[model samples]
Target: MKQQKGFTLIELAIVLAIIGIILGAILKGQELINNAKAKRLLNDVKGWATLEYTFYDRYGRFAGDGDGDGLIDAGAFATSQANFGANYIPPTSALLTPTTAYQNSDFDAPVATLEAAQLLPAAQNAPQRRTNVTNAFNGITYPASVYIDNVGTFNVIAVKNIPCFAAKVIDSNIDGSIGANVGYVREIDNTGALTGNNTWSCDANNNEQQLVSLVYFFDKRPN
Candidate 1:
């Protein structure tokens, strides 16, 4: 209180304005970061899809389905050793095989197979394979798996832990809306039903803003 030199009304206003600007800048920067992360995630998915096609084109079979039986060839089903590396073993069962036809779970065998075939980078083992793979933007781990739907279509499923993050990916790549016409479908959780969650819908009513756990199925044909 030696000077009691409180800022005048004008000074206070200026200070407040400066603070607002700084906050705005910080927020904008965060937004740009988020956008970049979303873009990277989308690119990774696309890259995987492309690799699936390339693998099929070169090997005449999908990556995880070594036998081309339209089922995930893993565990005892795997007949051939993964050629991507020396110690990598190909998945002998479907990593994307849902426990109850709806709930999704983490699988790394497909990734290992891809690595083994030189389609994806090789890892030391299954756990290492999974730990090494992560989303570039958010550092979120990706659960990569392959499976054949009942319709006989080969699918590569990539799991994202965050629903909103997945939404950003779908919006950036396919369509911004999480509703119909979107390239990817939304599911509540790995085990949850595949559809019927209106709240998570990116429809006009929902705005596709809500966040939940999501699994993305990238389908491809085994030619």
Candidate 2:
């Protein structure tokens, strides 16, 4: 009998099966990688915030001068830039012009306009001053509900990649207040006003703030 020159049907089928299995495993691994990346980004953001808080507690101000000046500016919370390892930058577009007075409306207007612009950028290479998503990860999308609490005029927000699920400005002392779950918030003015205390809590478990204040990045696996 002549030697077989081609793979048998059974062999071919087996090979295909093996290939399918390998592909499936690779896809699964990719998903895990994505999830891990998202988690890392989130953790990094948390750490950065913690660092800022620690630094402020020690130095009475945030690190990294937002302005070009070298000296650390006092009470300049909004302007200072915080690096979270990943290259996620905020928007540069001006909102109602810069003013000396602290205005919550300033943050609100830009967030609306900036988010609109970001979700729908004018160009592919457009310069971004603020980003709710991480550029390091693929398929990372920031939902509309991502925002900072604005109670007591706490406009300075600290969040990462999150969906449009709103945010909560919870005061530890507050009792059954309806304002804690107002969806994506832009600022949390002051924790003292709502709870008769000065402790602000941003909980991600709430339906209103489902994805807000979370630095998550995800990648979709092939089906």
Q: Model 1 misses residue 216 by how many Å?
A: 3.9
Global lDDT of each candidate: 0.49, 0.32
How does candidate 2 score on lDDT? 0.32
lDDT string for model 1 (1-223, tens) is 4867789999999999999999999999977877786676677766776776676676665555544554444322121112212344454333223221211222345566566567665566644554445565333333234333454433544434443655656544564464422346444344333444543554435543444444455553222
- Candidate 2 scores a C-alpha RMSD against the true structure in Å of 14.1
Give the number of colliding residue pairs in candidate 2.
30
Q: Write the per-residue lDDT of candidate 2 for residues 1-223, one digit (tens) a residue.
A: 8876998899999999999999999999976775565456545434444544453454343332223122122222222122221232233343212231223212222232333234223222222323432333322222111122452222122343243222222211122332332222232222212222222244334343233232211111011
Best by lDDT: 1
Runs off by more than 4 Å, candidate 2: 1-8, 62-135, 138-150, 155-223
TM-score of each: 0.67, 0.36
Worst 10 residues of 2 by lDDT: 214-223
Candidate 2 at 105: error in angstroms? 12
